[model samples]
Target: MEVRHKQATIDKLTHENATLKRLKFAAGREHFNAEQRRLLEDTLDADLQAVAWWC
Candidate 1:
């Protein structure tokens, strides 16, 4: 039981780390001006919030 719990935790952390890395890579893929960056960030925030709400 203890080993199973540890493995589950590891899996969750690994998934979250991968998600963050992907988000970072996507955000860095393009260069934006300050205004565009703010808009992009706002859009990402809204999308993330929607995802969290669903989760």
Candidate 2:
């Protein structure tokens, strides 16, 4: 059903956001610089916003 599909989408987005947060906060990772960190945070925010809209 449409409701179930929307719920699935929201769940997926939530998991993605959580993973991103874990990555962003993990210590000793030299790959991401300050700018990249900001970008990642922005993306996580956007994902959360989309989830909110779905709700």
Candidate 3:
């Protein structure tokens, strides 16, 4: 990927990862049901992979 595109992907994935982390771990907001949490976990894994590629 081009540098600019890669950077953009990384930024997006980083933001997603942070959001997921908050949703998964934040106090008083652990509203994810079991299935929803599972999906978020999967998405977080993908986000980590995407950010790792750019890094």
Model 2 scores what on Cα lDDT?
A: 0.79
Report every candidate's CA lDDT: 0.66, 0.79, 0.77
Q: Candidate 2, which ten residues in sequence have the lowest lDDT sum?
A: 24-33
Compute the lDDT for candidate 1: 0.66
Specify the highest-lDDT model's number: 2
Each prediction's RMSD over C-alphas, in Å, is: 7.0, 2.6, 2.8
TM-score of each: 0.50, 0.61, 0.59
Residue by residue across 1-55, what tens digits does model 2's lDDT show? Answer: 9989888987888698678767957756557779987898798778778777776
Which regions of candidate 3 are displaced past 4 Å?
1-6
Superior candidate under TM-score, 1 versus 2: 2
Candidate 2 vs candidate 3, TM-score winner? 2
Residue-level lDDT tens digits of model 1 in 1-55: 8788677666655665675577679766856689976876687667566545644
Backbone clashes in model 3, listed as residue pairs: none
Cα error, residue 11 of model 2, in Å, equals: 3.1
Best by TM-score: 2
